[model samples]
Target chain A: MNHVSDHDADHDSVYDGLLGGDDSQWAFGTDFEDPLAGVDTTLPEGVDGAALAAYCLMLGDDALVLSHRLSEWCSNAPDLEEDIALANVALDLLGQARLLLARAAAADPSVVPVLPEGSPVPREDALAFFRDQDAFRNVRLVEGDRGDFAVTTVRLLVASTWRLALMQRLVTSRDAVLAAIAAKAVKELAYHRDHAARWVVTLGRGTEESRRRTEAALATVWPLRWELDRTHEVERTLAADGVAVDPADVAAEVDVLLDQVLAAAGLEVPDVKRTGGLGGRTGRDGVHTEALGKVLAEMQSVARAHPAGRW
Target chain B: MSAVATVRTGYADPRAVAARVTDPEMPMLTLADLGVLRDVEVEGPGRVVVTITPTYSGCPAMATMRDDLVHALTDAGWSDVEVRVRLHPAWSTDWISDEGRQALREHGISPPGAAPHRDGPVPLNLMPTRRALTCPRCASPAVEVVSEFGPTACKASYRCTACLEPFEHVKEI
Candidate 1:
């Protein structure tokens, strides 16, 4: 891959070229090489490694699950460019999830879900592909269905907006790994927020059909958003210890950003009543919707088929 | 995350040879030219650690950059080479050197202008603004964005009205 032409970075074409050149670079699977290859991952004094692991799981799960949802649009987005956009966003989240999951697995291998006897997989893959829906710790905002383009755009706008706000503060975390991930992620999340915001405004102010659909999408997606803002006990504990961010604190800024986007899009913020929500079973508490189980069935199918497979 | 932070040995960094590695996607631009090269340092005459940041979180070129750095250093006879990626003071398009920006324009990619400060309260690109992008092909401010993303993740697709040529616009992060 040289600076030969415009084709070097084409997502699919890279695989096409690599397929012909190097057997080592099969171009089929992720580069599972350790992301924190040479960095010091030691926890600060008195900061519980287990607690930090849990916090990392909470953050990692959000990114992993949302990345899966976003990737669902790969070939189905309204246009070619949009398909690329969604995939780029998904890959960014996947990259973040990869690093954080590796961190979690490093801090507490005990939390890694069990797999078959002789099956070997990276910790991040094990966490993403082996866990049951009940074992996931991502918030509900990222676990549900990826709706129509309008709904997805609105959801992306909301999800990235909230994440950006949270990441801004996380960049200053006491944990170096968490801080680095946050520092890296906030930039990517900022683009996701803005990209979605553009579509949101375009749809919100487009033809009558577009306006109606955008409003309907907002109605469906806005209620689940509250689940993301509520602080889970694990996050709350880590927040107190300066190891994690409290979701509650990010809400005010998130609200302000959401309002700004909504206003610019000429859409009213929905007053959708929060459903049973994260009540007895919040996502951080390992509670997720049935949709997640179905999603995992599909996402993990290939790995489950050949447990020891290395692509 | 590896429990042990092992720095690979048998590498060299004479003249900062790795800094000359070009971005794999945009071959015309070196990583140093793009401001992706943050620092190159030698430790005790035995170790050379090169710190580089990715232009985007998902930029595919990062892996290529790292591998290129290691290979280049190994060829230069350094005993130990360490490449550390520091995410703090995150990489921004604003960091592109003046020379790099000039290189981008000369190579047919419009260099990004100043973006909203990360320190600013508002997140970037949320508001709709249709600033006429200056065209690299014709040096005209009459270019219109055709797509938010381009052939590469770091750029966007646009066409210049003056030259009527489609080109890449380096997105302001």
Candidate 2:
């Protein structure tokens, strides 16, 4: 009945790496390099620092909020494999978020709040956890509640497709940091979009129940799609500086990609009308949906409780 | 201290030491084999700096890789070690060394095929990526993907029809 082998008896514990005495190094800590290290972070000519930082916030917040939504599906996915897949996608977006947030803080350190002396929190962590809901700049498409699995997949398909298009153009940004981040992001978002597209097709072509649910999910998510294409003032300003992509420019490409995916799945594009904000003040203008408040509360609670906390 | 004395006290080749540090997730492959250890330099007497690139933007193993590089160089008698990450000219699976591919194969994992070449936007392909690979265990060409994602960000799960064995494939980026 003995399961222990000779090798096992040689060690007093099995979790050598986890239980090691090295308490200084933790995941997502200061061990990794600065995402912008060695890169020329100088501002481009005639580009306002505030505008550039706001643009980064817009993209970074979108990733951070959607990543949080995806992470909520950690153990709740339909199956183990899918659970892992969603987690992987979430982790990728989180990584992108960290870099983007760091870039934002670097571009405009004033946007980051002043914390207690010797606080271990990096500016990126501060931005992610300390911002008020009214300060967040994420589009509503990403901040909505995680609907059913099918709905989530549809959202992912649309979000990643649009992001990939934006990132593709962002690779040529006048800002080196944005260009580097975009170069890395384009590859990751493509994979994410592909994963979502495949699932959409599978579910759409599955049993009648699955197809019906997939279509319903698309209908629920389609109206929010227009907000992704609306160009905000910060984006418009940065675009003029050659440091940002006008989402409006990429809207057509996103539509074509989405249409292709829907056509493959034998599903029609939902004829839902585009939703709007109150007097043109959208998420980019610090006006977010109620869902964003709930997401930010949960995401920022732990960090706010102990601004100096490190694990 | 004399120049000769300083040379005697200095550590062995930092690159050699760094190249031997295995990936924390894929222990079978060293950082060099994984194509992440981009450069290793002896900055001064005991200070060594290592450079690496992540296979994916959100790779969880990156921090671990950095820590391992520092630990390995320290253990090899270097007093000061630093790791830097580069994102430009983003990492590609094509950089995986031949020996790295062999190691993955021996570990029952399929090595990645050539990376996709892009002149413009990355085209969307709903169909499964067609990879020319064989089962690492049985060398069977009849293999199908079980899941597009594996336990790690850079891998995918596959099943060999001939041997009926599930395996992981290091997906091309």
Candidate 3:
């Protein structure tokens, strides 16, 4: 009477190799190790670590949401190469999101409370499991809907332009993590901006229908542009410390670049009124649209499902 | 394993190593083949610095390529490797070598045509009408674009009626 043990079973052994075996020999480790270890954790003198973390979350959330929106067009893009291009851009933003979120979690003292023995939660776990949307600090442009190609391109141009400006300044940030992330992102955003700019010109100056549709998309998105320039005391504080972009400075440069792009396409800048009445302080105050909540659910769902599952 | 003992160590020249480092996205061409690997310098005893310029400002692979450079160099036994990214001269399709073009054609990607007349009266962006792309498979000047983009960002998808084959063409920058 031979008894088959579960551990000794051949079929179960094969399944274990496929599913649970230690396969860390891959090119990059697939095991769920934190990608942010060894990152410089010191904040600039006179800077509030918690505030900086909040600020970084805003930036990270913006990239993450926008990347998610762009990725939905993976196979649905006009062409195969364009599909690859969009996916590449989305991957770039996703990389930025990962680094920025890691930094935010590392900096925020409030997010990582003292354990039983007064030790703090690991930064990786904090970013992976903790934090909600109200804790997110991303901008309206990135969180906005993915409309037509024209709308997508317009938003890309606007977001990339402003991001480039901010990243240019960020290279000199007092925070090493911010500077490192910015240094890598500036180059990525430059290409993103160029890609969007080319599309905008092509669509805006193309046939009558294309031009009209692009103009309408621009008009629809123009009102949300004001939210990008909404300044806060935290931003001012960080800007003074040379750790964050002065939202006001980015606004002026963005306006000029946008104007030049519109002029080139022989299109007028839309006159849509800013949503100033609704208050532009929503993101900084931990307030967001229904879209963000939906996005967060999708993003965190997988990680939450199998809390400690390793691949 | 004794072949490893004969291998030269300590900061193998970047120019030599870079000759082998092809663009991951454009596998048909190497960094040296693309002329994007601008310079290689040996600093101090064991430190090697390789400089590269991106074809475009916001190319996502720039970071990955930098990491690749470091990994490749370090794996080859170079103790200290540094990759410096430069953007001054900005990459152009013109930088792509004839060898690279041949490789691209062999890989079913059409190399860019000669630069159109943009210096004269015509504006740079509006000047060139799309020219008939030659079938890389058959060399017949009868290919048509299936799509503006291909499997990757740098290439476009094209199909040749003559050969009845679909191919990826490296787009003109």
Best by DockQ: 2
* Predicted candidate 2 versus true structure: per-residue lDDT over A149-248, tens digit per residue: 9999999999999999999999999998899899988878888999999999999999999899999999889988888999888888889889999999
Query: Model 1, range A63-121, lDDT digits (tens) per residue?
Result: 88888999999999999889988988888888888889888988878888777676667
DockQ of each model vs. true complex: 0.36, 0.52, 0.11
Tens digit per residue, CA lDDT, model 3, A193-242: 76787778888889999899899888877877877787877788898888
Which residue pairs clash within candidate 2?
Answer: none
Question: Which of the two candidates, 1 or 3, achieves a greater DockQ against the reference?
Answer: 1
Clashes of 3: 6
Note the residue pairs that clash in candidate 1.
A3-B27, B10-B79, B11-B78, B11-B79, B12-B78
lDDT of 3 at B25: 76
Which stretch of 10 consecutive residues in model 1 chain B shows the poorest summed lDDT? Answer: B1-10
Candidate 1 segments whose C-alpha is farther than 4 A from its true place: A1-31, A114-120, A277-279, A309-311, B1-15, B39-48, B78-82, B123-132
| Distance from true location, Cα of B10 in model 3, Å | 18
Which candidate, 1 or 2, would have the higher lDDT against the true structure? 2
Q: What root-mean-square deviation over C-alphas does model 3 reach?
A: 7.4
Give me candidate 3's TM-score against the actual structure: 0.67
TM-score of each: 0.85, 0.92, 0.67
